[model samples]
Target chain A: MLWEMSASHIEESQDVTSQDLDEKLDLLSLQCLFLMNQVISMKVDIERRMKEGTGMLAKARYVMGGSSVSTLQIPSEEAGMTASTLSSFEESERMIGKSLRLKYYNFRVFPSAKVKDDTEDEVKDGIEQKLSNLQLDPRQSQASNPLRWFGVLVPNSLREAQKIFGGVLLLCAECSSIESELEAVIREIDILNQVKSNRQQK
Target chain B: MSDFPSSARPGKLLAIIGDEDTCVGFLLGGIGQLDKHRKSNFFVVDKSLYPSATNIEEIENAFQQFVKRDDVDIILINQHVAEVIRNVIDRHTSPIPAVLEIPSKDYPYDPSKDSILRRAKGMYTAEDFR
Candidate 1:
């Protein structure tokens, strides 16, 4: 009679555990759905922007061929063109849940010319290297014009292409963060699946 | 001493491995960079310019090289070009230096073939929720 009572209690606890796992799995799947939608929309946006940017680029190439832009062309090696990234990713973790989330941040444009000066200042302040101590003057930041690398007198088509692609680059950055989140949700679902299967087997 | 904000620079690069037009468009955006090693973060896989010149190995190599680079935080490849090296792209498991397969001038975006989307769909069906 005692064995029967203990068996009924164990069965009741098993049912509750499996029900909890099911609820968790459903929540994760819903998260996956949301993330999947976000990614697909971003992909569509990327496609449209890329098509427009490339079309403008092709037009620029054609215009260059018809004109004397060749004389103004800077050799790849000589241009020495380098751009400071305007975006970055920050990683944070939920220690209890054991899940990772990547956050994307877009920074203001800092011209390459100013980068050297900033490095020097940073070196001087090495004693107090805390990021909070550094006071960033907004007016000090300048608009980034990469077309200056080609020449001050670049074709209109080229300028338009640059503007279009710049937006696309930011979109790409945002998409990466969303995609990473989707990966995390999928991982959670997989773990729950293993737990559910293990329970069933036992 | 200018009271400039502590370096807003993220110091990370976005690498591209795409066709001619894709490379040109993005390069014009000011993401183009050439390091002291004379190595560029972006690689152009153009077969139209030099017909049949770009091979699978070259594409794979560029993708692998970009993945190995520590400074690159994001790698963007054209969807059509990514098809040539789908296996390599799928094999990459790192969440950092995220790999994003984007559309190109000639090809449109297809979500079904997207590596991440496919994995999500494969994991669970709508009926499973029911």
Candidate 2:
């Protein structure tokens, strides 16, 4: 009888141990799922902002060109219109470029191996470096060509967005930040487990 | 004396003075010379037309004329251009036309380094907000 009791107790202990391990695994898996969701959301937000910035820039450029072509009848009027439009376009381009650069900087500061792999960090870095060089070029200082600036700034902004998305992914991994939806799922599972335990106890 | 927005003015104009890119950007924005017949709405003066040393004088003259005209509402100048005519820009007190310094294509927009931002920071620091 003592042997039998010992065997039963050993079986009970083993069951409890397995249950504990299962709970731990469940929690870990839930956390990982949550983190993934957060990273995806961050990437979406960054992309949306980038698109908006680029769209604004393109619109401004179109306006600048359209206005200049139409105002050519009067020399003074044409000159003034041309100058103003060019300045506005330049400002728009600069603002967009700055936004992209900020994103790029954020991405560089936060490194995510998975997202970075998808973006191909080396390609992004090369593009950004080329843009930086273009900005530093002496010809840009001597002459202000709105068209040239537009060409360089737009592509740079797009590339910067790609880098930023990778950085956002890295931040999520580092902080273990999870999405609200995933958190809700984890909570629901925990509550269900509690209900089951209560019923079993009763 | 006029409380209306500058855009409502029959002769509201904006002047931009700076390098080729800066001037070109302004021009692209529809700023043209003063149209006496149609009520000029905007004007941009490219300082590149003047010798480097005379750039400030030309900008000052343009600003004086812009402000004197009841029609002009805003003046947008490149940061470098503003630097050239800092004395006049700083001394002018009327709010008829707002003056703003903008970044050119060659210059990156550095919010932290912007004079306006710097002033704000200074004010915040003085008030212990920072």
Q: Compose the digit string of candidate 2's lDDT tens values, residues A1-202.
A: 1112333333333444445535643553444354444444543443343344334444554655543322232344322222221111000011111111000001111111111122333545542342232222232222232233333344443333323323322322221222222322333333334444554687
Off by over 4 Å in 1: A1-16, A66-75, A93-145, B1-9, B49-54, B125-130
Considering the two chains of model 2, state its CAPRI-style docking category.
incorrect
Q: After superposition, how far is residue B64 of candidate 2 from its true place, in Å?
A: 2.2
- Tell me, by TM-score, which candidate is best: 1
In candidate 1 the C-alpha lDDT for residue A87 amounts to: 43
The TM-scores of all predictions, comma-separated, are 0.74, 0.35
Residue by residue across B12-114, what tens digits does model 2's lDDT show? 3455454543443233323444454543433344544644566557668766776776644455555556666767776764433445455544443344443
**Model 1: colliding residue pairs:** A136-B4, A136-B5
Which stretches of candidate 2 lie above 4 Å from their native place?
A: A1-74, A77-202, B1-11, B37-51, B110-115, B124-130
lDDT of 1 by residue, A1-202 (tens): 1112333333433454676777766667777888899899888988987888877766876876643322133236524556544445555333222232323222232222223333545655421232223222233233334555555566788767766676677678778877877776776666667667868898
Candidate 2 TM-score, true structure as reference: 0.35
The residue-level lDDT of candidate 2 at A138 comes to 32
